[model samples]
Target: MSPTTTFQDLQAAFPHWTIWRSSADRLWATRNQRLTDAQLSHGLSHTIDADDADQLVAQLRNQEKLATGLLPQ
Candidate 1:
């Protein structure tokens, strides 16, 4: 194919791919929530204090927000 043709094809496909990947990411997140919660809980067990729990939760929330923000818009 011509370079222009390939460029146009990519211009069309890029958004679709972005949407597909985003949906997949969100689906994975939904499916993983319970496992993630359990893992977080298990990890927090080693913390053993209210301050530690708060710190853990805060850090996790910040990380999650950062992760979500990094996803395609």
Candidate 2:
């Protein structure tokens, strides 16, 4: 079965980034109507795996923190 994550879940976790899944079971993220560097480096698509989801969450959180200066550069 394809792994699924709801928009609500991701919205609650990282409201700063847009999140969604592709028809082919790939996860995607974007900020300011553009793909993140991580997304670009990893490719625009990701397999629906728990590890990939976790990493995406982490990257989004970091992006949020960096934007808000919560984390030092």
Candidate 3:
């Protein structure tokens, strides 16, 4: 499958985030919900960006870990 299709799949899998590619071809995902100060203190953010789909997915997964308390902030 093409990268665009993979990205769409990622977007579907991560409904809480809005995933897209920039004009410069960078991958980005923005959380649907705003982050509180505590969450920010925990190293969570409202947005993430990567050079490619795989990196973006990895970052998204890390964000999930942070959200679920699986990883130290």
Top of the candidates by lDDT: 3
Strongest candidate by TM-score: 3
Ranking by TM-score: 3, 2, 1
lDDT of 2 by residue, 1-73 (tens): 1257566788677565567766766566765345456655643322222235766676675555445532223
For candidate 2, the clash count comes to 0
**Model 1 global lDDT (CA atoms, 0 to 1):** 0.31
Per-prediction TM-score: 0.26, 0.49, 0.84
**Quick one: RMSD of model 1?**
16.5
Instruction: Report every candidate's CA lDDT.
Output: 0.31, 0.54, 0.82
Instruction: Give the C-alpha miss distance for residue 30 in model 3, angstroms.
Output: 0.3
Residue-by-residue lDDT tens digits, candidate 3, 1-73: 2546586698887888998889988988999888888888998879999987778888988889889962233
Candidate 1: tens digits of C-alpha lDDT, residues 1-73: 2334332443253322211113222210121123245445444221211123234334434434544533343
Better of 2 and 3 by TM-score: 3
Candidate order, lDDT descending = 3, 2, 1
Q: Evaluate residue 60 in candidate 1 and report its C-alpha lDDT on the 0 to 100 scale.
A: 39
Q: Name model 1 segments beyond 4 Å from true.
A: 1-51, 69-73
Give per-residue lDDT, candidate 2, residue 20: 73
Cα displacement (angstroms), candidate 1, residue 49, comes to 13
Error of 3 at 21 (Å): 0.5
